[model samples]
Target: MDIFSRPQTERSPLIDFDFANRRLRIEGESYPEDAASFFGPMFKSLEGFLADVSDETRSAPISVDLRLSYFNSSSAKALMNLFQMLEETARGGVPVEICWNYEADDETMQEFGEDFGEDMEYARFNLRVLDTDVS
Candidate 1:
């Protein structure tokens, strides 16, 4: 599977899907005019990559990092779908890790991640508070 990387914009997040490394990261703010339109291809590519995970690949844990500055309700729903896919994949015996990164002061985003993590039953979810001070 090829790597999928997309540049971030005012309305969308930066997407980095390293299929070979079994790591995927999505960052930045997301309030796209059309959430589905922006995420449709992403979902397709991720589904394909996850579905291709074999027993050999299962040994190395697959990880997903989501660092969202902010996101609308639609984007949140899309994220839930993504998490659900990961949960299902993990349930199928794949070692999976989901890290939700948020700015230290962003209470809303932190709570959002916690809520999302609560919904995930199969995959392990970690809340990582990002360093807000940039030196």
Candidate 2:
């Protein structure tokens, strides 16, 4: 099942939730008009997927990569929820990895990644700031 390609909006982040092969990614800037409203469904969908995990689950050893340049505080909360869901899934025997990628110059994003990483246990979250040409 494919849960990628979020609806285009005036202020929304791009999403790529691939259920096949156990890799999920959310990249690009995120400053949605309504953070909670936009992220609620996303959290719900992720939870639903994890709830039905069995022997034949497509998403095992899940890897979620987040490369956001800017996200409001509300979005940060929503992100925490997402991490929580993934952490729970990992604790249930399924290994999980969250890669938080940020621009090398952006210390804010690096710190944000560290914050999220500190909160997780089962999931091996990585805080990697890369030098990219976003210009």
Candidate 3:
């Protein structure tokens, strides 16, 4: 699953989805004018990657790392569905872990992570706050 490797866009995040290593990362902002238009292919790619993974590997785990500074309400809903799919996969015996990363001062993102974590019963969800002073 090859994902965003170009210059950042205003409407889409940097999709670094990798199936071979089972590491998917979405960073930056998400406020696409057409939420479905953006998420449609993204979700399709995810499904395809997962399918290929299921066919080849039996016990490899997937790790999702999300670091978004902002997202529209529609995008938020889309993200929820994405998490649901991941949770379902995990329940199907494939280990999955989600790391929701946000800026240290962003409470909205933290709450969003908490909500998704609460909804997931099989996948392990973690909320990570990036420190601005790390540099």
Best by TM-score: 1
TM for every model, in the order presented, reads 0.95, 0.88, 0.90
In terms of lDDT, which candidate is stronger, 1 or 3? 1
**Candidate 2 global TM-score:** 0.88
Compose the digit string of candidate 2's lDDT tens values, residues 1-135. 557558544467777787756678887777887888788777777777787779766345888888888888788888888888888888888889899999888999999998889999888999886767669
How do the candidates rank by TM-score, highest first? Answer: 1, 3, 2
Q: Report the lDDT of model 3 for residue 133.
A: 98
lDDT, residue 96, candidate 3: 95
For each candidate, the alpha-carbon lDDT, in order, equals: 0.92, 0.80, 0.83
Pairs that collide, model 1 = none
Which candidate has the highest lDDT of all?
1
- Candidate 1's displacement at residue 51, Å, is 1.5
Instruction: Assess candidate 1 and give its lDDT.
Output: 0.92
Which residue runs does candidate 1 get wrong by more than 4 Å? none
